[model samples]
Structure formats: C-alpha cells, structure tokens
Target: QQQVRQSSQSLTVWEGETAILNCSYENSAFDYFPWYQQFPGEGPALLIAIRSVSDKKEDGRFTIFFNKREKNLSLHIKDSQPGDSATYFCAASPNYNVLYFGSGTKLTVEP
Candidate 1:
C-alpha cells in the first residue's frame, strides 16, 4: 500500500519566488518526515525534516511545515532559483532508518 502521497507530480516557480511542494501520509505511526532533493544524475539528499512533535523545520532556503493532526506537510523553497530545479521526494518513517516515499514532485525553477 502506498503510505505517502505528493499532490503534484510537477511544480514550476519563477526565480526569487517561493515554491511549495505538498505531501500527505496515511499512517499515524509515521513520526519522522524528511524531504529529499535530487538533481539529475545525483542521488537524493536530505533537504530538511520535521518530527511529529514539531510543526515546522527550516534549513537555509528550505522549510518544512508539518501538521500532525492532519497528517500532511509542505516543503517551501524560498528564493527559488534555476539551479534549484530537481525532483523532490517526501518520505516518512516510524524510525529513522526505514522510509516510505511518495511519488516524487519535479520542481522547475524558471529563470
């Protein structure tokens, strides 16, 4: 069964604007949420993450807004750039090691 879901398969944003990627999960047991960013020919890297206990997490230009009660989250990329174009995956885990991923959202930052 698919435990995670991304609302859009692709998203486009103009440079300097904010790009939002949305995700939701089925299992309430999923406590850790991590968003991974992948560029062409490169493996997905951990972009940012949030625990169930917190409503949000931020790292540099990336921010994850989480809603525990709703079981949904959104990743916001501030000041979108052409170099930020990539596929983003939203993943969840009961523990840190094992992750269930959503169908990725391809982000296009137009310059």
Candidate 2:
C-alpha cells in the first residue's frame, strides 16, 4: 500500500511565483486532512482542510501546512496566476469515512 505520498508529479509557476506541493502520510489513523483543486475536467473540489489538532489551513490563495508529528503535509499556491493552473490532490481520511488520494499535482501557472 502506498499509504499516501504526493511528492510531485508536476509543478511550475511564474506569473507571480509560489507553487509548492509535497505531502506524506502513513495511516497513523489519518485524521481527515484534505486538499484538492482540479481544473481540467473538474472534480476535486475541497481546497484546504486540516484536522488532527490543526497546524495550518487557509482558503483564499490556497495554503495548507500541516505536520501532525511529522505526518507531513504541504500545499501553497499564492500569487501564482494563470488561473492557478490545475491538478492538485492530497487527501486523507480515517474518520469521515475512507478517502485517500495523492496521485496528482500538475500545476503550471505561467503567464
């Protein structure tokens, strides 16, 4: 099982700069942490989320830096323009049911 790891499949920004994508997970009872943002065909919705006592989570330009004891988590896309590109998923859940996805991260916000 790959537990969950979205090191990176794609990422490139320039319009304004700011496109980081790094996530890690290994169960540990996961704690409902979600972060999705798609724009190709449209599906992934939730933009920011953090549970496990919360470490950080924003919503405007997007931001989420959680590290529940090093479970690992990251997703920051500020200024980055160009419609913020697309493709970004780093999810996990062990409370609100099952939900584990980290096979995506193709953001190219170059203008």
Candidate 3:
C-alpha cells in the first residue's frame, strides 16, 4: 500500500516564479523526508529534505515546509528556471529504514 501521496500529478511555473509541490503521508512513524529531483534519463538526486523535528528546511532556491501534526509537506522552488523542470519525488522513512515514496509530480518551467 502507498503511504505517501502527492497532491499534484503535474505542475507548471513561469520563470522567476515559485513552484509548489505538495505531499502528505499516512504513517506517523516516518521521521525523515527526502525530496528527490529527477531529470530525463538521470537518477533522482537529493534536492532538499527535512526531519520531523524541523518545520522547515531551505537550500538556496529550494525550501521544504513540513507540518508534522498535519502529516503534510510542501516543496517550494523559488525563482524557478527552465532548467529546474523535472520530476520530483517525495519520500519518507521511519528512522531512516525503509522509504515510502509518493507518486512523482512532474514540473514544467516555462521561460
């Protein structure tokens, strides 16, 4: 069964705008979240991440907003560029053990 869920199947954003990808989880045991970005023909790479202890995590133009009580999170891509277009997967783990991934959200950035 799927434990993680993404709200959007696809998203579009213009250059310099912020792209938001939302996610939620069913397992409260999950403590670690890693958002992965994948380009065509390439493996997903760690974009940004957050622990249940942190309500937010920011890395340059990328930021993760997490709400442990709500069991939800969102990834914000600030100043989005065309090169930022890709598929993003939200994954959760219980004590860094097995990971549960959400169906990816494909992001399209228009310049």
Candidate 4:
C-alpha cells in the first residue's frame, strides 16, 4: 500500500492569496517529509522539508506544517502568484531511505 497520500486532485488560488496543500501518510515509520514542485515538461524539484522532530519548516514563500502524531502535514504557499502554479508532490522517506510520493496536487494561481 502507498504510504503517502494527497486528498485533493487540484486546487486554485487567486494571486496574492495563500494556498494550502494537504497530505497524509499511513506509515508510522516515515519520519522525513519533503515537498516537491514540478513544472510542465520538467522534473520535480525539492521545495521544503520537515522532520518528525520538527512541527514546522519554512522557506521563502513555502512553509510546511507537520503533525507526527496525526501522520499528516500541509504545505502553505504565501502570496501565491501565477508563476507558483505547478504540481506539488508530498513525499516521505523512512530513515532517509527510499521516498514514497503522493499522487500530487495541481495548483493554479489565477490572476
């Protein structure tokens, strides 16, 4: 069974609004969580990450809120822009080993 899961297939946000992408995992063994952003005809790139020991991690415009007990996490994009539109994937690794990726959430930032 897949360990990581993304409930939403797609999400839309107006420019300058914040977009929240939700994710969850079934494996308690999973500790490290990383989110990947990918554009069309391109490979996924690492956006931000959080460990089991951390409840939150933040980058420039991206932030991750994690709950170890709930086995869930969310990626918040502040001041979403049209360029921020992409397919975001939630991935988890156990002991820094193989990574399991979720289906992915497609985000569209409308102007």
Candidate 5:
C-alpha cells in the first residue's frame, strides 16, 4: 500500500501551452503529498505540495489538483515554454517519511 503509479514515458509541451501530468496511488495510508520539478542533471525542487486533508495546491505557474476520494492527482503547468521543459515527478510519503516517487514525466516545451 505504498506505491505511486506515475507515467513511465515523458511528455512534450509546446511554448505557451499547459502541460498536464497524471499520478495515482493504490495505498490509502498515504498522507503527505508533494510534486517535484526537476531539470536536466539537477535534483528535483519542491514545487508545490498538498496534504490529504486538503484538496488542491498552487504555486506560481504550477498547480496541483488532488482528489482524496479518488486517490489520484495531477499537475498542471501554465504557459509552457522551452525553459519550462523538464522532468516532473509526483511523490507521497506516509507519516511524512519514506517517499514513494513516480517514474517521471519528460516534458519538452518546444519553441
């Protein structure tokens, strides 16, 4: 009950377009949720996060929509660009520890 099923393949987004990545979980014990934004050869940065107690989270051009009842979540990027292109991962932890990360989404924002 500690698994986060994420997209195995990468995604491509054009400039000024919104990219949506998907994630889901089978475990109900998960409580802490976080979405990480990563660039080439760099560790993921904590973009935005939301708890199961909450519904949604947003930060700047990034937004996370979570559904506790459905046990699913998604990340929406506004104004997609070449610079905004990168790999994104959705992660969750039980008791705020032992994070389970998604495979990853490779987003190429073309110009």
Candidate 6:
C-alpha cells in the first residue's frame, strides 16, 4: 500500500483566497513531512515542511498542519495568486531520506 496519500484531485481558489490541500499517511515511522509544488514542465520544489515534534509550520504564504496521532496533514496556501497555481505533493520520509510522495493535488488559482 502507498504510505502517503492525497485526497483531492484538484482545488480551485480565487486570487487572495486560501487553498487547503489534505493528505494522510500510513507509516508511524514517517516523521518528516514536506510539501512540494511543481509548475507545469518543472520539477517539484520543496515548499514547506514540518516535523513530528511540531504540529504546525509556516513559511511566507504557505503553512502545514500536521496531526501526528491521526497520521494526517494539510497544506494551506494563503493569499493565493495565479503564480501559485501548481501541482502540490505531500511527501514523507522516515529517516530524512527516501521520500514517499502522494498522488498530488492540482491547485488552480484564478485571478
């Protein structure tokens, strides 16, 4: 079974609005979670990350909310803009190496 999973296939949000992307994982050994964003034709880039010791992580307009007990997490994009439109992936790593990625969620930010 896949260790990481993303529930939404796509999400749409107007400019300046917030977009929420949900994800879950099955491995308790997974401790580090990172969200990656990829523009069309470009490779995924690490956007933000959170550790099991922290429930929340924020970087600029991106934030991650993690639930260690539920083995789930969510990425929140604030003040979303058209440039923020991309395919977002939720990834996890147990030993800080060999990441397992979710199916990904396509986020379209409309002006």
Clashes of each: 0, 0, 0, 0, 2, 0
How big is the positional error of residue 77 in model 1, measured in Å on the Cα after superposition? 0.5
Query: How much is the lDDT of residue 99 in candidate 1?
Result: 96
Per-residue C-alpha lDDT of model 2 across residues 24-92, encoded as one tens digit per residue: 999889998888888987788987888878888888888888888889989888789998799988989
Cα-based TM-score, every candidate: 0.96, 0.32, 0.97, 0.97, 0.92, 0.97
Candidate 6 C-alpha lDDT tens digits along 1-111: 888999999999999999999999999999999999999999999899999999999999999999999999999999999999999999999986699999999999999
TM-score of structure candidate 6: 0.97
For model 4, give the 10-residue run with minimal summed lDDT: 91-100
Q: All candidates: CA RMSD in angstroms? A: 0.9, 10.8, 0.7, 0.7, 1.6, 0.8
Clashes of 6: 0
In candidate 5, what are the lDDT values of residues 83-104, reduced to their tens digit? 8888888999889558899888
- Off-target runs (Cα >4 Å) in candidate 3 are none
lDDT of 1: 0.95
lDDT of 5: 0.87
TM-score of candidate 1 versus the correct structure, residues matched by position? 0.96
Off by over 4 Å in 1: none
Q: Considering summed lDDT, which 10 consecutive residues are worst modelled in model 2? A: 46-55
* Cα-lDDT of candidate 6: 0.95
Candidate 4 per-residue C-alpha lDDT over 5-78 given as tens digits, one digit per residue, 9 for 90 to 100: 99999999999999999999999999999999999999999999999999999899899999998899999999
Q: Each prediction's Cα lDDT score?
A: 0.95, 0.86, 0.95, 0.96, 0.87, 0.95
Model 5 weakest lDDT span, ten residues long: 1-10
